[model samples]
Target: MAGPGQRGVGEPPRLLKIVMAGESCVGKTSIVRSYTDPHGAPTSSSYLTTIGIDFKVKPVMFDDIRVKLQIWDTAGQERFHTLSTSYFRGAQGFVLVYDITNLDSFQGITSWMKDIHEKAGDEVDIILLGNKCDKESERVVPKQKGEKLAWEHGIPFFETSAKDNVNIEDAFSVLTKEILEKKSCVLYDFDVVALNESKKRTCCAF
Candidate 1:
């Protein structure tokens, strides 16, 4: 029996695993915390360093689909690199964060993307986010360059201010939509059938 707003049996809810990665102090944790708890007061400062990885689950309704996003926030410093790769194994989506006010952080995006591709592979969906967009005076990375990079990588780019709540929801929503649309091709039983057929063809050719 279906609950009031639930889908019927055998139909799995659309679930996505997303990871946030960037250089140290690039505002990855702030973005995640803001999105998860929009009404909560802003923190004075980031208190704890993300040791290895942290997880949070948030359910959102996109059109008719119910999406449960499993968000993984990883440590961004070089020391945490080894610990971080393990969390990227099964990621379906990624949010590559960079601080607009920090040139070094923005430049380091290429390295983050490389790590993501090396671990999660090229097929995983990714969105490039420019954090701290509200700090116009300190903005170092031009928005156009971010867009260009995102285009080159075949991913969407968003300029967000987690502190001011600017484009915060929009960025996340776009990611969810992209994941549901692109990743949907392999999420269910039909993909299993396709895989079996592919395997059969390979075996028969041997």
Candidate 2:
């Protein structure tokens, strides 16, 4: 893991935008803070609702390639739900977070996912995150419930505790790898076409 603001000097790091979405007070902002905070500060479990939107960046290195993750945290209120659609534009990935103790929040994931695909298109990558997993005593949604929902939507699911710093890094790492693989595939296709064009030009010159 690269430290915050740490990157190579040669080429500009490729920026990938990811949006955090779910019902209000599902620890979306906490998750973002936990991931981007370099000093490993403890995130508070208290519910703090996001008003509108805020974003932060974390510089990361994967296989010697520097990448910057531009993570956007959005308000999850019903009024702001429609507002999230606007920010969905150009987002490469979405982390749908729900509190494990709140079954209603978990139920809200489907609605959020619909808005995501409606605004960001079907090709955008999504991951289902069951937050506050450390609260086992108060858990309303079971582990298999989250897994079943994720499977139904064909997206990866993770149980994370932002306050406890559990699975936060692992979940983000998996999402980053998925996005990078898609980007690498696109670049590879472009290179193949460019190489073929060069061959045609060379044959014509001869």
Candidate 3:
């Protein structure tokens, strides 16, 4: 991962805007910090809730491409919901985080997903993240339940611990790959049309 203000030369890296959404105190901010600055020390578990939104940008290499992710960590409180939901606009993907230790947090994914789609559109890519896996004893949301929810909705899923740094990169990587794939499809269609146009012009010239 490239540090802040650091980027590779050549073509400009594609910017991918992503949002972290879930119930309050689900470690959304921690996940953003971890993924953007993996070398930094892990965030303490007792951090206060986000007020409105936190933002970060990190450059990552995937295959031959470098993508700069614009991550928005939105507040999960009900009062901030309106303000947070506005940030969902133009986001290419979302990380719906929930704490495994809190059953209410896990159950809140349904409503979060609903709001995300309402603002960002249904085609936006999403991943179910069960956070705080390090506290195994406190885990109330079983892995199966999370997996089932993911499967039922056909979205990718992973268990992550912001403190332990578990599956955090995998979750982001999966979402980025989906974004890149969609971009590739659109570019390929343009190329096909361009090729057809060239063929028609050459035939007319002959």
Candidate 4:
């Protein structure tokens, strides 16, 4: 029996795992917090760094289907690389973050990209995010630079300010859509193969 507004028996929400990775102080944690808890709290000046990896699960509805996103917030420090990198194996998508106010953080993206390719493989979906976009006076990495990087890498890009709640939902939504599309394509291919096999058996019967 199906409860009101709930999926019936055997119809469970799809599970998606996503990870956030970038250099230290790039606001990856803030993005996760903002998306998961839109009205939780204001951004704090003295925020503690994540030690190893923290995660949160959020359920969202898309096209009448419920999807549960398991988001892992990874530590950006080099000491935690071994631990964080291990979480990338089963990720369906990733949010690669960079601080707009810090040129070094933006430059460090090369190493992060390398890690992604090495751990998550090249086929995984990724979205580039320029955090702290509200700090215009402190901006060092221009929007054009982020856009160019995304274009070169063939990924979508967004300028987001987690403190101000800018484009946080959009970024996650884009990645979720990509994951669902990829999953749908895989299922479609399997169905086509099964149909072809069925046709072969039917012809033999005749």
Global lDDT of each candidate: 0.82, 0.84, 0.85, 0.86
Question: Which residue pairs show collisions in model 3?
Answer: none
Name the runs in model 1 displaced over 4 angstroms. Answer: 1-12, 44-47, 183-206
The whole-model C-alpha lDDT of candidate 3 against the native structure comes to 0.85
Candidate 4 wrong stretches, greater than 4 Å: 1-10, 184-206
lDDT of 3 at 31: 86
**lDDT, candidate 3, 127-202, per-residue tens:** 9999999989998999999999999999999999888788999999999888777763223234547789999999
* Local accuracy of candidate 1 as per-residue lDDT tens digits, 1-206: 12323343345456678999998787888888889887893851644667888988887776656667889999999989989877998888899999998899989999889999999898888899998888889888999989999999999899988787788798898887777767443254455577899999999999
Assess every candidate by TM-score.
0.82, 0.82, 0.83, 0.84
Q: What is the TM-score (0 to 1) of candidate 4?
A: 0.84
Error of 3 at 22 (Å): 0.2
Q: Which residues of candidate 2, in runs, are more than 4 Å off?
A: 1-9, 38-40, 184-206
Clashing pairs in 1: none
The per-residue C-alpha lDDT of model 4 at residue 177 equals 81
Instruction: Report the Cα lDDT for residue 173, model 4.
Output: 90
Location of the lowest summed lDDT over 10 successive residues in candidate 3 = 1-10
lDDT of 1 at 140: 87
Q: What would you estimate as the lDDT of candidate 2?
A: 0.84
Best by lDDT: 4
Count of backbone collisions within predicted model 2: 0
